[model samples]
Target: MTDLPAATAASSRPDGRASPGLRARLPFLIPLVVLAVVAAYFYVGLGRDPHVVPSVLINQPVPELALAPILGRDRGLTTADLKGEVSLLNVFGSWCVACRVEHPLLMAVAGQDLVPIHGVNWREPTPQAGPAWLARLGDPYTLVGADPDSRAAIALGVSGAPETFVIDRAGVIRYKHTGPITADDWERTLWPIIQKLRAE
Candidate 1:
């Protein structure tokens, strides 16, 4: 039989000596590089304090919400209620264990009367439960508002229970605390911010 042309190295694979073109290998390398970048991003993120989630609502006006009073005797709370003075707007739920954990600190702060402490009773199983919980825990809120459907919570960009926002005299959100505010956090972080906002 007539000899066919010798197969070039580019077409030969059995010897496993030929290098693959950059284009042929790029697809495989790209995913590995992307995965490595993502892993490094998560590694850096994991080292960060999990409690500190940045809030986009900072320096913006508080969300407008006209919420019913959680307790019968208290007036309903609104965004307008947050105006005229610096206040702490706390988002809590009767079912939140962390909220209960932070209750004493809130009570202590409220007792000091350093600033008005408002409440958004977010996603409580029942409206009545919010009042009872507050009553049992010694209601720390100056005005407690029920957010049964979480509409107000959503508007305020609440991620979960026990978050707190510092609102300025103009009803702007000055800062946000993402987790349970412990006595240490209150003294170290929240109290200082509250003091500064009050002065302004």
Candidate 2:
């Protein structure tokens, strides 16, 4: 039988020193490094920030908006529909989980008579889903507009559902809330702001 060659001292690390050939394997570490970078990128932008939400509407007129009037009703909600009252323009959809969670807060808003609440149903897959969702949840909206295309949402810089934009009687967006409204927030933050705007 032919004798086979054994690993030399250079190839084997007896004293805890890897060979030069093994050092070349370090390049494979790049993938792990890349994954960490990508994870960090997403983590940083995870939370909501009003700065990123286009501030163009702040202290500016509400963008011109027209949407399918109403689900089965004669009236529709629009900028024109928003006339003569300080109100809340709630951007939501029936399918949105956050919107569902915020339902109680909305009902609370209604109870307080803080302001008229109008809904802008954004990018609803179907009109039926939106109205049905509202009907099931006990509709709080004074009027609802079907925005299946989300054009109005884009114009408002609405990144997600359950956002509340406060519009003055003059129809300018004054304050915006970016996530589900909480009990404390409805009282301490939102209600106070709405009252201030109303007073002004």
Candidate 3:
């Protein structure tokens, strides 16, 4: 006896049970909409953006100026001193809360001993106060420069304290960071640049 063939169900219903072509395309649109929302989120409201200050003398020879004696040292600091080695110039003052916030980071930077740090005490109440403060905490700066009048700071184009500049052996300003340091900043921005400069 011959067996009857099995009947297959229709793929689509003739009574319009399936969606139209445009309705089928709607699911594919979801990913695009999500991506656009993410892009707008980053572009408009994200606070973790990288600082992008334009450098006037970056990669160029650092300007020359003499800073007054630091921590009551007899000899003064000069541009010539910054020419021979890779160093970090940290602008700070005893009165700046942000500067206090970065003191520990500066200490950690000192622990690395990769390069020396020079503190430019900008417009401070007293030069002795800085050394005293460091003495209370720890002195990360190998040499500190007193710019109580901000003459040296103005020459370096520094607008405020808690700003740091990485100077190369050629006396060029390489990298700069404003505001307090963050863990992500250390991992992403500061360390990488320091490593690059160290290699060169």
Best by TM-score: 1
Error in Å for residue 107 of model 2: 1.5
Residue 134 in candidate 2, Cα distance off native in Å: 1.0
> How close to the true structure is residue 93 of candidate 3, measured as C-alpha lDDT?
83
Error of 1 at 112 (Å): 1.5
- Where model 1 places Cα greater than 4 Å from the true spot, the runs are 1-42, 49-52
Model 2 lDDT per residue over 62-92, tens place = 8888877657766776688776788899999
lDDT (Cα, tens digit) per residue for candidate 3, span 63-116: 786877776566656778787878888888888898888888889888988678
lDDT, residue 146, model 2? 81
Decoy 3 TM-score against native = 0.71
How many clashes does each candidate structure show, in the order listed?
Answer: 0, 0, 0
lDDT of 1 by residue, 1-200 (tens): 13534565445455656657788788899889999999999999899987566889999999888998875656888889999999999999989999999999889888988788999988888768888887777988898888899899889888788899999889999999987898789889888998898787
Candidates in order, TM-scores: namely 0.77, 0.72, 0.71
Q: Rate the local accuracy (lDDT) of all candidates.
A: 0.86, 0.81, 0.78
- Model 3 clash pairs are none
